[model samples]
Target: MIEVKHLHKTFRIPAPHLSRWERIKAAVTGDGAEKTAVRDISFTVGPGEFVGYIGPNGAGKSTTIKMLTGILHPTSGEVRIDGMSPHKDRRRVVSRLGVVFGQRSQLWWDLPVRDSFDILCAMYRIDRQRQQRTLAELDGLLGLGEFADTPVRKLSLGQRMRADLAAALLHEPDILFLDEPTIGLDVIAKRNIRGLLSKVNRELGKTVLLTTHDMDDIEQLCDRVMVINHGSLAYDGTIGELRERIGLPTILRVSFEAAVSLDNATEPELGFTVAEANGCELTVHFNRQELPALEVLRRLERYGTAQDVHMEEPDFEEIIHKVY
Candidate 1:
């Protein structure tokens, strides 16, 4: 439902003003240097696909989203939503999209949440029956009824976020653009937002392009991920594919019946590194692709009688750090 080709956005930084003479010289000579926010990035998101666009704070994730949504023009590229250019036909293209920026709100501050919804329905020309149905569904999924009648200014951050999400979806757009949608919420609130997003993506079949620093959100919701760094596409694939590409290590913790001497421990031809060791307990790090878990266990058996064993995948934060 979304396509971007050779996308690039450059912003000119303003020069510091010194004197009137210098200002005139700058006006004629163009003193500002250009910085590229997005650099020749290209990707396509299919219908009903949930994709995560991730990067560090200054990595151009939001800049790309803005270009895709027609909020900002690209320096030289093409962006299309459902085969129509968002730049050339913004109104038509945007009608099929719902966007939510975590730091901003579409709802009026002094009005009740329901009032905002009513106004949005009118603006979108949605019929009363459709608006009610949409709100009823939102209430069930988001638990918005708790603050539906409350003024937006009075609602808690979590409540207000939920309302904003509801507002985004009221028109039942074909696609959802979510940028840092779970930014400052508490654990429970973040979980709620993630759950709602998952439902909106999977069950409702909305094509979603989410830009977030929250790796948990990507791990939980996205079927595929696109990583951006230094204004360029760094990675694009499934989480598992990314882990293998980056050689993200899997950890195995083994507890022995008795204290084992490191000198006596038999190392296999394909050996693993000791991440941590204390008395009878040892933590081993190995790439599962290179040395299988079974082989690691077998190697451990020769060292000492095993008491217990546990294994874990690399955390999402570690994976993102590798991307950076």
Candidate 2:
């Protein structure tokens, strides 16, 4: 479990100098520009909850994660993990948390995958039996055996990601913080990582905080999501609640057997907004609360033989767009 309260983080950069004399003038003036990365954001993650922390670039997502993981201290406010302050007891807190940054690798580049794991186990003071068990479980879940003997530098991006995930979990931490874990991965690799995250959260009972640009990752893995923009919390709720709040209509594209003129036919009492219409096909936007999808389908059956019907759900990007 994690709790953050009124968190604010700001960085101060030296003001630009106009000339050699101006540099001295600025230094004497003590003038600097302060950039606020995270501004008074607050949230909580209950045990075993899988949360998606999402935002556009420079949205303070990574900054928040770093603060939670004790990599960077917060400027103000408090961050507590399982009732313990990460900054106060960083070493102890780290033992109970797993973190993976997609842009950085914690593994030794020249070392084989197994060697890195071995070193990590030694660093964590893990017993051989426990390390073996963890490695075996990760190997089974992530299919890491294929590249266990290969050096980290030689492994493909997907393979390295899997290995990094395994390394992060070797100690079986209670919470996992994944910062763009599936970045640069192909479709299959992304799916594999998503499945693994779901398993870890649901089956393994690990609390997961994931930040990604991929909406599929949020849809597939997160039970709850928090959207941030301009260094603030814009939206925080269940995925369903978020979709409903946006009034973002679900798109239903349907193709009828024959063209039906709207002027002559009596309008069916369907609780859906007609987004667009052309010839035999009509794009309908409906509120999930007002009309269940099954009922909509049944009503559409009355029009004509439905050739094709495709439904599109509002994605995370769309939701953020509405929030910002």
Candidate 3:
């Protein structure tokens, strides 16, 4: 489990060079040119929970992760992993945690994948029998056997990623911090990694905090989502709740028994605006808050015999844009 309370991180950026008059002007105006990467954000994650931390570039997602993992100390506020401060109790806390950054590799570049696992075993002081069992489980779940003997430098992107994931769990850490673990991966590769993450959370009971730009990764893997913008928490809730909060227009495509005129397709009673219309079909967009879906269907029935009706909700990416 993880807990963060009123966390804040600020960086003092160098001010741009200015002329004598400009410098004097800036000094008089009281401009310090400071950047706040995280602004008093607070959240908690329980054991066996998978939470997605997402935001745009420079939105403080990585900064917050670094503070949580003890890589960077916060300017103020508190962070505790299982009631132990990460900075104060780093060794113990890290022993119970795993981290995988997609852009970086923890494996020794000159060594074989198997050798990296063995080194981790010794580093963590994992018993030989338990290490082997963990490796076997990882091989089964992540398919690391195919290239287990290959050097870290020789494996492809997907292979290297899977090997890194296996390495992170060799000691069976309690929490996993994943920063864009699926970046630059293809569709099939992404699916494999996501399936492995889901198994780790559900079957192994590991708490995971994932940060990524890919919406599909969040949709497929996370039960709860937290959004950050301008160094502040913008939204924190279930994906369904996020969708409702954004209030994206719902789209409905209706087919009729007879050709309907596009000119007469506007229906204020149903609270739907015509998006498109063809020979025997009309595509309309409406706010679900304005009219109930069932009522929209009832009104469509009056237009014609109603051959068919199909509705589509907004995609996760669209909802994220709405957040900003």
lDDT of each: 0.90, 0.89, 0.90
Question: For model 1, how does the per-residue alpha-carbon lDDT over 87-187 read when each residue is reduced to its tens digit?
Answer: 89988887899999999999999999999999999989999998899989888888998888999999988898899999999999999999999999999
For residue 232, model 1's alpha carbon misses the true position, in angstroms, by 0.6
| Candidate 1 Cα outliers beyond 4 Å, as residue runs | 18-31, 265-270
Highest lDDT among the candidates is held by which one? 3
Q: Which pairs of residues collide in candidate 3?
A: 96-174
Candidate 2, poorest ten consecutive residues by summed lDDT: 260-269
Better of 2 and 3 by lDDT: 3
| TM-scores, all models, native as reference | 0.95, 0.90, 0.92
RMSD in order of candidates: 2.0, 2.9, 4.0
Decreasing TM-score order of the candidates: 1, 3, 2
Per-residue lDDT of model 2, residues 1-324, tens digit only: 899999999976565656767766666785567889999999999999999999989999999999999888999999999999999998899999998888899999999999999999999999999998988888888899899999999999889998999999999999999999999999998988888889888888999999998888998899999998989999899989988888888888889999745552336566676777789997788888788888887777766778988999876677767786
Report the error of model 1 at residue 167, Å. 0.4
Residue 158 lDDT in candidate 1:
86
